[model samples]
Target: MSTLNLLRCAPHALKKQPVWVAPSRNIALSSFLRDAPAATASTKVLPGHEYYPGKEEYGTVIGNREIVGHGEIPYYSDSFMVPCPAIRFKEVDEELGKLREKEKGDWKLLTLEEKKTLYRASFNSTLEEVRAPSGDWKRCLGDNAILIGIMFFGLSVIGLSDPEFEPITVTNEWVDAQTEYLIKRRVQPVDGISSWYDYENNKFKPTWSIFTTKETSQSVKTLSERGV
Candidate 1:
């Protein structure tokens, strides 16, 4: 195979990318590499892809995988922590068939290309590829920003559409009247803003009379006699 074709095969680190999006899966590979008896329609791999490279052979079915109709091969997924996926990505072609035979021997005997081919047959991407930082956050932020701006624009449109809906109570005259009414009622005479008023003098009193200033404590005593 060309060098490019060899590189097309993947690695475990690149295995991390979630681009290999898949859900839970199921597949039944018959243990012996013989023809499946015509009696049964092999249950499909739940992940939605072919596990066996060719139609003639099957591998031993692993786990609680239920075998159903003939279709939909298993796939790889980062979200799922399954150590072994239900099926391989591709079938056993001539080159891969040879690698599988050699794989049964010592690890040191296999070339780097053969090792990579085995890994790719099983996994879609390296772990790092699955866990790689995709800039999805930028898209989310942009979408939310647009949504907020739309909401703000809607609020501004409503506000501008009806000038009469604006609150009248925020005017200076209204505030002054509200303050006068509160003072007239002697509201909160105990340790509150209203307590600072001198009703007899018709004015607000200095709180310096309560707290000992740099001047003296007599100011406190004088203020204490005011029934404040």
Candidate 2:
């Protein structure tokens, strides 16, 4: 047999010898070597459409305006004028007139005895004799001296007898007169001008300004031009 025929037919030598083979590219080596999907048009960034920093980049943006911090901005209008009501001096005069008439009527209706009783009560006289004086002595001594004498008698008789006695009767008319007097004293007009005024023209402006000053300031003007 020839040499080539003899090598091909040699089974013992082929089984003992090592075989050398080239690696195939079609076989997968690892899981990382697998093909990835292609990116869509939406994932890609377009040219000249890059992000740019704005003026309010670091602050809060509201209606295209950036606010760094709260500033001193007044929410109210400076030129806004407040409404004031006019003073009605006529009404005050009428009320005062009515009070005066009532006081006169009450005074007229009050008897000499009632007046004397009120006088004694006002001075806080406690002596029963002075409170209800008898004989011509009360008529001659007058109310003032009688009240003084009663006070002196009360002080002298303190340890001898209890000075506590019945209180004098105060009428409803007296109480009403007293209350009206106090209210009138407080609410009476200062220089005859009862209402507030803003000197814009010849007309009188009515405001709720109750404060009155002897002299006018730059912001506040006097109610009366004639000093009432």
lDDT of each: 0.52, 0.33
Name model 1 segments beyond 4 Å from true: 1-75, 91-98, 165-228
For model 1, residues 65-155, the per-residue Cα lDDT tens digits are 2121123444434433544454455665677667766766787897887787787775667555766887999999999999999999999
Q: Which numbered prediction scores highest in lDDT against the true structure? A: 1
Off by over 4 Å in 2: 1-162, 166-177, 181-228
Candidate with maximal TM-score: 1
Task: List, residue by residue over 1-228, the lDDT tens digit for candidate 2.
Answer: 755334322222332343222122254545223321122212332221111123233223222221111222211111113011111111224544444344345566756764444333222222333336357776777977889999998877874576564334344345434433433354334433323332245323445234533322212232133232
Instruction: Report residue 104 deviation for candidate 1 (angstroms).
Output: 4.0
**How well does candidate 2 score on lDDT at residue 196?**
38
lDDT of 1: 0.52
Error of 1 at 223 (Å): 40
Residue 115 miss distance in model 1 (angstroms): 1.8
